[model samples]
Target: MTITTTRPEPASADLGTDPQEPAGRRVLTGDRPTGPLHLGHYFGTLRNRVRLQRQGAELFVVVADYQVITDRDIADRLAEHSENLVIDYLATGLDPESATIFAHSAVPALNQLLLPFLSLVSVAELGRNPTVKDEIAHSRQSSVSGLMFTYPVHQAADILFCKADLVPVGQDQLPHLEVARTVARRFNERYGAGIFPRPRALLSEAPLLPGTDGGKMSKSRGNAIALAADEDETARLVRGARTDAERRISYDPAGRPGVAGLLQLAALCQDRTPGQLAEEIGNGGAAALKRTVTEAVNEHLRPIRARRAELAADRAHIRQVLRTGAERANAVADATLAEVRAAMGAVGSA
Candidate 1:
C-alpha cells in the first residue's frame, strides 16, 4: 500500500457531547501530547469517550502535559505542544461544559498527593511495571528520569485526585490502573478510611488501530493517521501502508498486517466488522482494498477536520475551556488532596 497525504486545517465544530442527561458511571481519561492525536486515539478511546458523554456520564479528560515531560530533562516546546494537543482535543469534540478538561501542569494539588501515595506503594512493585520497561526502551535514554520511572505514580495522582470511580484505558494499561487501586486500597487500609473508591478499567472495544507501516499506531512511529491530516494525506497514507504480496485481499492481521490495518480502519469507520468488510472486498487486490478503506476514512474524518479548524480559529475560547476545566477539576482535586492528607495524618488531629 502507498498513501499520499495533505496537511489539513484544524477543525472546531462540536461533534462532542450534546445536551443529554448524565449516565451510569463517571469516567476519567486523557492523552499525552508528544504530538497531535491520530486515528489510533479516536478508535482506541476517544470514540468510547464521546459515546459515554452522550449517555450522560460525567467524564474528565486530562491533557497530561506533565506526564509527557517525564523522560526529557526539560522541554522548550512543552507549552506550545501542550496548547496544540488541547486544540486537537477540542477540535475532536471535547466539550468544556459536558466533559471536564485540564492539563496536569495546572493542577498542583494532584501532584501533592503523589508523595504520600508513593509512601504506601513499595519500590519493588514499581520496578516490576512492564510499561516502565517498555517506555525506557523506547526512549533509549541510558536510564529513565525519576519522573519517568514513577510516571504511573503521577497517573495514580491524576485518578485519585479526581476521586475517579471509573477509568477508561486500553488493555496495556491495566497494570497502572492496578497501581492506582493499590494506592487507594493501602491508604484506606492504613488510614481507617475509604476516601478514594477503587476505580475500574472501562476498557476499549475497538481493535487496536494499526499505523500506516503496519506497526502500532503511535505518533512516534510516524505510522499514524493523524486526525488533523487532510484528505489527500489520509489517502496517501492508506496507499503507502504495507500490504501482502498476495495481490488479493484477505483480513488476516497475522498474515497481512498492512491489508488488515486498512480493513480495521474501514471496519471502525463503517461500523462493520473486519470479517464483514473482507467479504465486500471480493477479488480486489491490496490496492483496491486500500482505496475503499481510504475513502471511508476520508469521508468520516471530513467533519472532524472542519470542526477542528473552527476550534483552532478561536484559540482564546479553547484556552478558556481549559481554564474553566482546571477550575472545576481543581475544586474536586483540592478536596480529594485534603482528604488524602488527612488520611496520612498530615492534617490537624485532636
Candidate 2:
C-alpha cells in the first residue's frame, strides 16, 4: 500500500501564459450535443470556461449541434440535448450573460464561413489529419459524409468566425486547432488582410480523468457519471467502478489504471494529491477506496446537481438564454463574414 509521489507535469507547459490572465482575450470553446457531459467534460473544459468567464474573457460557448450529425445518421432529441447541455453549463457556474451559449445551427453566418475556409485548405491536408481520422474510425460508419471529411475546416470556420484569440484544448485536439491556425494564416496572406486572429491553444493543466470502468469516459458506453446524476446514481456508479484485486490501494497508474483512476477521481474532488490520498488509505482495500471515491464525487457534485435541477425546471429560461446568445453570436459572425467578403472582392450583396 505504498504511495508514489511522481506525476506528470500539467499540459499548460505548452504555453507559459497564466490561465488567470483574461484581459481582452476572446475564447471560443464548446461541446457537441451528442450526449450528456460527465466528469471528463467538467475537468477537461467546462471548469475552464467558468473560470474564464469570471476572469472577464469574452467567451463564446457553442452548443455544437451541427457537429453531432457528423457521426450519427439522425440526431435523436437534438433540441432536448442542446438545451440539456446549456443547463449543465449553467449548473456548472457559466454565466450566460458573460458567456454566449448558443447553438451552432442557430448561427448561420458562422456556418457560412465554412465554404470560403474550405478553399484555403487542401483535400490532402484534411485526409492526413489524425484527429479527423480518429473521429471517423470511432464513428463506425460504412461511409463518411462530405461534411465529416471537411471537419477541421468547419472547426476553422467556428474559431475564425468569431475572431477568437484563445481556444482551450488538450493534446488530442491540438491537430484540429492547428487547422484553424493554418486557415487564419492563409486567409490573411492570400486576401492581404489580417482579418482573423491565429487562435492559440490555452492547453489545460488538468489530467485526463478516466471513466469508472478505466476506459475513456463516454456517455454512450455508460461509463460516465453525468453532471445531472443524482446522489444515489453517483454512489451506484462509483460502487460499480472497476478496480484491481489487490488488497492494498496505491497510486500506480501504469501498474493499475483502474485503481489509479479511482484515486485520481477522489483527489480531484478532495483537492488533495492522489499519492497523498493513497497513502492515507494505506491497506484499506478496494472497497474502502470505492467508498472514499463515492463520498468525494457525490460531495463535490452535490451543488452542481441541485443547480441543474433548478435550471432544468425552467425550459423557457433556457431557450431564452440560447436565443440571446445566438443573437450576439450572429452579429459578430456577420461582421467577420462581411469583412471576409470585402477582402475577397465578393462584396455585392447576398
Candidate 3:
C-alpha cells in the first residue's frame, strides 16, 4: 500500500494544546481487551509506548472494551479481559504515573463525540477502509455487525477526544488512522480549523511476529504466547511450534515461514535482526532453533510474569487505577466535546 505524505491543514491557534498534556508531543494508542496480550502486542506497540512515555510524550492507553464487543458472541468475558489487559500493561512496563490508562466505556463523553463525527464520513467510505475490510476477512464472519463496520468512526473518537497529536500504529493500521485524519479535516472544514490536530501515524519499525503456526499471532488461533503465560506454558508452546525438515536455520519468511518465524521471535527477544540470528545459529536445525527461542522468550517474560502476578493479586488497586485514569480522560474528552457542540451550535443544558 502507498503511504501518504500530505499534512493536515494547520490547526487554529485558539485550539491550542491541552494543559494536562506534557511539554512535548502527545500520543493515543490502545488495545482491545479481548484476552491476555501476547508477544505480538509487545513487539508491535507496547514497547514503543513504554519508550515514548519515558521520552515524555503525553500518552493515553485505552482499554478498548467497546470495540471488543463488535464481533464477540460472549460479552460477559469483557470485564475480566479488560482487567487482565491492565495488568499486562503495567507488567509490560507502562507506568501509570507517566501515562493515563483508561477503559473506553469509562469516558462517556467519547461516545457523545462519535455521533457528530459520523456525519462527516459516508457508509461507502467506511466500507472502503482497508483495515476494516481486512478485519472483516480475518473475522471470517458471514455477516458483519454495524458496530464492527463503523469501528473506524469509533477509533476517530478515541484519538480526537484526547486531541492526540500522534497515534502509534502498524502499517496495516495506517488506513484506520487515515480515517481519523479525514474525519478531523472534515470537522475542521465544516466548523473551524485546528479543533483537532489531525493525528498522524507514528509507524512502528518493529517486525511483525507470526504465530507458532506461521500465521498472524492471535488468541483465537491458540498459537500465541501471552505475556502473562507461565514458563512451562511458554516452553511448551515454543517446543510444539511448527518448523520444517532439512532446516539449517534460515530467515526466509516466504520460503521457510515456520523456521523463519522462530528466528523472528528469537531476534525480537535478543534485540537483533532475524538474518543476524539466522547467521549466528547456522546449521543448528529446527530443534536448536526452538530451544533458543523458548529460552529467550521465557527469560524475557520472567520479570513481566512476576510483576503481573503481583499486580493481579490486587484487584482493588487495578480498579482504582482505571477509575483514576477515567476521571482524567473524561476531562480531556469533555472539553473536546464542549468545543464540538459549540462549533455546531448544539444546545447544552443549563
Tens-digit lDDT track of model 1 for 37-125: 89998877776677777777788888888877676655647666677777777666666787988888788898888888888766777
Model 3 lDDT tens row, 1-350: 22234533332221123433334778899988878889999888888788777667788999998888677554668889999989988998898876889999999999989899889888877877788888888664468988889898999999999999888777777788888888888889888756998887766677778999999898889999999889899889998999889758889999998888999998889888889988888898988898899888988888889999999999998898899899999999989888888888888622
Q: Which regions of candidate 1 fall more than 4 Å away from where they truly are?
A: 1-24, 347-350
For candidate 1, the TM-score is 0.89
Model 1, global lDDT: 0.78
Q: How many backbone clashes does candidate 2 have?
A: 0
Between candidates 2 and 3, the one scoring higher on TM-score is 2
The clash count of every prediction, one per candidate, is 25, 0, 2
The full ranking of all candidates by lDDT, starting with the best, is 2, 3, 1
Model 3, residue 61: distance off in Å is: 0.7
**Candidate 1: residue 345 Cα off by (Å):** 3.3
Each candidate structure's TM-score, on Cα atoms with residue i matched to residue i, is: 0.89, 0.94, 0.91
Please list the residue runs of candidate 3 whose C-alpha ends up more than 4 Å from where it truly belongs after superposition: 1-23, 140-142
Q: Model 2 over residues 1-350: C-alpha lDDT tens digits?
A: 11112221223433335656675789889989987899999987888788877777899988999988888788889999999999999999999887888999999999999999888887888887888999999884678998789888889888999998888888888888888888888889899998998887887888989899998888888899899888889889998999988988899988889999999999999999999989989999989998999999999999999899999999999999999999999999899989988999895434
Each model's lDDT: 0.78, 0.86, 0.84
Q: TM-score: which candidate is best?
A: 2
